[model samples]
Target: MRTHNQRDAPGLRDSPSEVNGKGTSGPEPNKRRGIRGKIINALSPISVGKAKIKHKKKNEEREESKPITVDQIRELIHEKKLFEAGQHLLMMEKASYAEQSKEGKGAARSEIEAAYGLLKQEALRVIKTSVRMAPVNPELLQNTVRAIAEQVKEDKTAALEKANVLSVRPRLWKEAWKEMIQESVTERMQVPPFDGVEGLSATAHSFLHMGKAMKDDLITVVQHIKPHYPNDFRVCCVYAECYYQCFSSQLEGIAQFELGSGDNALLLTWVQNIYPNEIKKHRVLEKELEEANLGTLLPLKQIKHLEETYLINELESLKRCLARCLQMEVTRWTQGREPEKLDGHFHSELSIDAIQAVYGGQKRAKDITPDLGKQIAPLLLVELLTFLQSYKKELERFLKDNKQRQHFEATVIANINNCLSFRTHTEENTMPGQNAVKHQISVVLHEIQNAGFEVLLQGLFQELQALFKKFTQKTWLSCSSIMNEIIGCASNHMATLRTLKEPFRQAIVEKIHLHLVREHIARLVKKKVSLRSAEQQGQLSQVIQTNAATLHAFCTENGSNARWLEPVLPRLAEIIRLQHTDAIMVEVGGLASQYPDISKKHLAAILYFKGNLSTSETRGILSVLDIHLSATLPPTSLFSDIKLS
Candidate 1:
């Protein structure tokens, strides 16, 4: 029935007689003599030492009775009570260190150290379990990995080894890498005036550094993750960038060492290695863009802008790389030569075969065959054409709807602006050896004029040719209607292409006129005509007149060069005149035959007065018919005998 404190420390309960007079529990002072007590206290140090030893032993026993467990440490870790867990582990290690300092306590220290190690192991297991629970969370993975890294940082070799193993897990590694990239971008964004190559390079360097630090780790992670996101453009771009950093570093070093040394074999090797996949990526991006459906809840303008922006960035990156390659070649070729002498010296070095090789031979060998360094120009032209062609059908479809057309036009304008801005940026940022690169870009632009016009003409010609062929076989009314439709379609296309430049506008109009309208008219003239009755003849006459008049009006309204239609107009007019004259003669004959008493004078007057007949020609016809004319009756009454009325 002892109190808890007394039971815990029985010496205090049994020492009442030895307590101090002030009621503190302690050994009682001896009453033999005051001087004797002082001498005894001063002489005995062993008793005080024994009391301290006893107190330390009791504290140790109390600690051992309620020892910390690995499971408790793990629970704290699971609760994310990391600071508390660390404190507990630190306390345990400190206790072990203290115990090792004690005499005859080597085995106790070993036991404490083993417990601490087990606790650390449990903490790590808990972290792994948490990560597995939320593997896809980038922030969580990043934080957990960071914590693990910090925890093992004192043993850097072991920490890096563990990090390597952890980063190889596909889900964990991707989230960690993406988080790193996003953090880098955020950091770069914090700086001011961030809008050019410097900003771009800063951001790119983050990825480059990470790739350098974790080369195999990054590659392993990417290879494992790519299958799940095949068409993810961002992932594709990042992957390309990693490859670029890995491969370009070696190439860059080689170029720097070989600069102005007249050795381009190294640069060419780099080009051959890098260009194939880069060009292949372009084709892949083009295919993806072509297959993308713009029909969604998202605004068409935004969708188009994003798609175009992605493509522009990719193309610009390729262009920049190509420019760098060209620059290196220029520098290499111009070594030991005066700046003036370097002019046109590197032209022949730029070959389509090299470029075609870069595209993995996807382009026809014939198409890419170089023309005195013009091969790169046309190769790039083909790329631009492919981009435009992919969107052509969709654009046409867009034009069919008013709202879509407005959105499409806006997108086109935005794309053009972006192109201009890119060109200006390239020009402004020209490096030392980029003159040749600029020349190549200019050549590509020039080639686009011709190539784009050809594509435009080819498309319009095919369409109009079919329409013209259809017009030639149909009835005149149907033919006229088809012609009008063709004209309208051509007009719309011309208007659209006019956004490009004068060459495109002029070429489209000229081609449509020459191939469709002019051909249709020429073929119409060669058609056979067979009139079986007067009514049929009249109908034929009317159809011819209406078709001719319609064609004339269309040409006039459309600003067509009228000289081309000169040969066909007069023939059509003459046919109408002759049909009218024939009708007039037939009517005159019928009237004369009905009135048997009709006089020759009346007949001559009637014939001369007919609307379609010329006066002199009418008189000649009267003489040929053996009819006589007399001055006889009054001029106004001369036709009185021609009718009974």
Candidate 2:
């Protein structure tokens, strides 16, 4: 019987010799030769002729076969036997063509179309079946992708030299990490429970292993990647964290090596620039440092760049100032509990000797000797002040030369006396009371007044005032208590101004008031203006010129009023009302021309004072600024309608 395999060769059983049952019968020689020649012609065409003949033959075979059943096609496809399915379609087409040939060409073509339609439909069914049978293997895919990446990396190294690898290093690192993570997941996820992992259940053990493995890989990636991807702040920070956790052992090896003979100071400076937030903590990372683990984690190269190039000398100087922060062990052991308490011994101020001592203490047995006491002393002192502020409640009251001390006291008393006669606080003085509560202001005004203290009371207030002034001039390690003291001293001094001589009293009072105005300007500008700036100095001069009028008014309200203050009133008035008018107008004009980034509350404050509004009304005007005029303003003038006093 003929089978599907028999279809490969036609008429084998029906040959003349086979039908006669003659196994060795010879055909007529010429006839056999003609048949062989015809066969050779057909075979030669099969080797070289148009592909259409094979297609026609296939179509004929399909026409003779039954139409493919959807289920049978699905089984072949699901088993991934697509070639067998195609053969079955061809057989069916052959059967159809052979049966329909007697009909017209149109009928034969229609039969061929039917067979083709069945084939295409069955192909789609097989596709769906195969897709459903495919296994979900993300791990396998991930590993395969990783293998491709590794191959690419090696190829790149071969094609492009290893020395120029930085160009592709970041991408390579990212790929490597991605691959490592995938591999870790696969290993931990696919692996079954084994001996020595008995404590954890299957699910728990899998997760634990995966987590630990991932952590290690992440840390490794970060350690290698952090120095390269600096602009990516997120990655750098993540790497920093991972370095601490995953590759801690590797980091410990790094720590054993000294930062070496490079410029540590410069390196520190760079660390501050790039990793400013890290330095903002004031403590260094344990792994990146040697000695007492106090140095910064920044590399030497970065630090040198900062010290050599960055603008803003103040910030750089500020960093230098911070480095001198007192080490607690030496200070507490040698100088006693406080700097003030160490009166008999040489003070632990920021001198060259002091810095050396602190540095030496950290080294246990090593000596750190620095020369040049004059310069070193001041630097060390500044450092100590910053450091002390970080740790303690108050700074030591350094005793200046007696003459200088007297001068300092005069400056304080004169300013305070001036503010008392000149400036007025419509609100209750809350600043001094607050400082007293904070323990920053040591002696209260009431206590001094009760004791009937005159010179001593003035001295204490002046001392507080001088301290506040000094604090403002430099960068302190901390400002909480220091700020409270300055605010309190100013409040108390303003309350006491009229009690002092008129000349000194009014001048001091006006200077204090001008400083407050300047403070507002500073905040608005988002930049520092030294007290010596021409604009600020000019403002102060005008405030002094205006104080005579303010002082007279205060004296008139408070007592039989000093006539001395009255004479200077016009001069003061002219200074405030006219000379500064142009400058004030300029600021206002600028604000009018361009919307300032400053808070409207501050803008409205300057406006309120400019209008000479009453204190109660000034706050109300500011409230309007905070609520209504802040973010949006109509093009119409804000000040055009409001009248100035």
Candidate 3:
């Protein structure tokens, strides 16, 4: 064993050769140990642990100091800008884009550059902010993203307002809708990659509530604004649209109460008032007004009142107006005549106009009574017509008395007829050997037809033969008498036609006017009854709908005079229908007790059916019989199966 000093092992720093077994100290000992030993010692577990700790600390520091890769920076920037980094990635990673990138090769390389540039700017900003703040808080990032979204929305709204495209209210409505879309877009952007699909789908449901609010506001505005501008066409259109919306909003309101309000009285009156003013007082508006059937809005009681009042007014007006017009016209006519003012030569010639004037007023006065000729005295219209006929006859007699003029006119007519009857042969038909007779009958017939003497021409050939026979019998008497008789017959026929002209024309015109008046009143009554009868009993309502129209028509015509004639037509129709039904019923059974009235139709029907007449034959008999109905029958079958009754 070595001494204590040897045991102490020479101090490494003090001596180089103090130790015997350990060899050298300090640098020489460390060198003699060999690099492998040192290296092995350095790699021992304890040393390795200390070195690993130090190396880890150094690596963390280096990572913190190095610049972030462009991709990571871009990701951060995208998250801050759009608030939807993953969604953006997904959009960029579309299958189409990916395929294009794979297949297009270098062609789409510029798009990639653009994408990188965009990402780079975004990432740079995010990074710069993150650095300034030292660390990025998640809440701050979210708030930043929301603020950006708000700014984008504001920008879009500003742009729309700047455009000044639509009217203010409509534009506002559109902007509201656009804001909703922007919100949805912003929501979708906010969704993370994992939550994106569900978030988008959920956001769509918000639009339903939004849509309802929009419609409600629009309707409220229209309703509020409409009444202020009643005559404005635009306002009217809007009001109508809004009303339609309200109507559609509630189905029950549309169906029950609204529709049953029946005619739109106010609208009808407005149209009636305004249309005439706009169309320049056209006479055709009268017909249009009638067709529009504004009276359809009136109740039955109102219609009856209108009919009575209007009938009185129209008759009163016509009477006064006609009398005044006739007096004026006659005065004008009388002005043309002058008197010689000599004793006997001052004979007054009765003028038709003077007669018409005197008689017209009388006719109106006569109409005020029940009896036509006796009680009412003669109507001026009747007297005027009678006077005209008598005057024509007197004129004819005077013409005949003046034989020279009469004979001249007669001779002219006869010579014209004779010349027309004398047919000449054309050169083509006048060959030497051809002896054909020319037919002059057609030429004579044409001349007579042209003269408006068709009745005289009807017995053309026979009359001509008679004339020829008369010419041969007795020269003096035959020529004068036969010729005079022919002329007299023609003159008498012409005189009759002329005298009856005014009466016939007046009768027809009055009849037509009455018919139109009756038809209009009938329609008015039908409309009035229809409105009331909608809620009435079915059978009674149907009767009103069906026969009331026809009955009302007659009531409208002739007023009190028609009261007698009015009931006759319906009674007749009822009698006919019951008669036909009873007749057909006879084949199976007896007539129903419902129809109890006796009439010509009933009797005829009983006779025909008992005799077993065919349907066609029965109809023919009824038509010829001209039977009127007096009552109606029940719904009991006339045939066994009722036969589509």
- Pick the TM-score winner: 1
**Candidate 3 accuracy as TM-score:** 0.16
| Regions of model 1 farther than 4 Å from truth | 1-451, 457-474, 477-480, 522-528, 531-645
Q: lDDT for model 1, on a 0 to 1 scale? A: 0.42
Q: Write one digit per residue (lDDT tens) for candidate 2, span 225-334.
A: 32332232243343334333332232223334434222233232223432233322324332332212333434455434433332233224444444444343223333
Candidate 1 residues 295-396, lDDT tens each?
A: 221233533333333334334544554555445533433243322212222122323322433343223222322221233333444443343333333333
Judge candidate 2 at residue 445 and give its lDDT: 20
Worst 10 residues of 2 by lDDT: 364-373
Clash counts per candidate, in order, are: 2, 32, 8
Q: Which segments of model 3 are wrong by more than 4 Å?
A: 1-307, 336-645
Cand. 2 Cα-lDDT: 0.37
TM-score of 1: 0.22
Off by over 4 Å in 2: 1-32, 39-645
Better-scoring candidate (lDDT), 1 or 3 = 1
